[model samples]
Target: MTISRWKPNVTVAAVIEQNGKFLLIEEHTAQGLRLNTPAGHLDPGESPIEGCVRETLEETAHAFTPTALIGIYMARSSHRTGNKEDVTYMRFAFAGELGAREAGRALDEGIVRTVWMTADEIRASVSRHRSPLLLQCIEDYLAGKRYPLDLIHVDESVR
Candidate 1:
């Protein structure tokens, strides 16, 4: 039998903050309603930064300009109640500026609404988080950890 390589799903997230509140999205998960950062998978042919910007707009109805890399995280889930297989995700989280909302724009499927929460509020609701990374990203952002956006280089062939 041939050994198959394990591949982790790549995702991007935006840690948008203003006036001490961080922006988060409430969405329907197989487990039920959950909160997460404005995040999603990286699309084919797009860089992580580009994917982060796109996902932020799609999930929160606001434009996002990623300024710095917040952190890279890897997490694994073992047979979640409704999931048939174990899964791992590699996330590139960024800190960014969130712009004005797009008029009448609809959020991505499964997204119910966007809410701004203080760090205390987030800490209080850990049980409702979609993933631990949701709060870890925020904590990393609050601790003033950031890497230059140029840290990631996409090959010209991908353009």
Candidate 2:
């Protein structure tokens, strides 16, 4: 007899700001068109904060400096690649500042475009969000949500 193994994917979220506007992406989702912050799976050997900054820069063409971790989210969903494979994700959402955009940098694949939207505009687009947490993250950010950078402690042994 044989058994299968499962692993929960680790992901990072970036809540980027510029002149009071939040950076977001419009993407295609199983639920329909939806908006989301620049986010993606964490690469091996990279800390959550590093992953967040990398993803934000890749998707938005702007540098990101995560100041606080707003919240962590977990969800199970089917793969969109027609395999319909079940997958679970551990997402680290962070609030941060957006630095200058890089010239000649292209947005990551699957991202349509990066746009700046106010909290109210984000609220109005609830129906278009890739996930329910899209609006929730924004609301939390607007609510002054914050957690110390030290909140996430990575044991040096893991490095």
How well is each residue in 1-159 modelled by candidate 2, as lDDT tens digits? 898788888989998766778889987766666699889899977889999999999988888999999998888766466566677878899998888889999988777888889888888888777766677777788888899989998777666
lDDT of 1 by residue, 40-151 (tens): 9999999999999999999999999999998999998665675586889999999989898999999999999999999999999999999889989999999999999999
Tell me how many clashing residue pairs each candidate has: 0, 1
How displaced is residue 135 in candidate 2, in Å? 1.3
List candidate 1 segments past 4 Å from native: 1-3, 81-83
Top candidate by lDDT: 1
Error of 1 at 126 (Å): 0.7
* Lowest lDDT block of 10, candidate 2: 76-85
Point to the candidate with the largest TM-score: 1
List the global CA lDDT of all models.
Answer: 0.94, 0.84
**Clash pairs (backbone) in predicted model 2:** 34-128
Give me candidate 2's TM-score against the actual structure: 0.86
lDDT of 1: 0.94
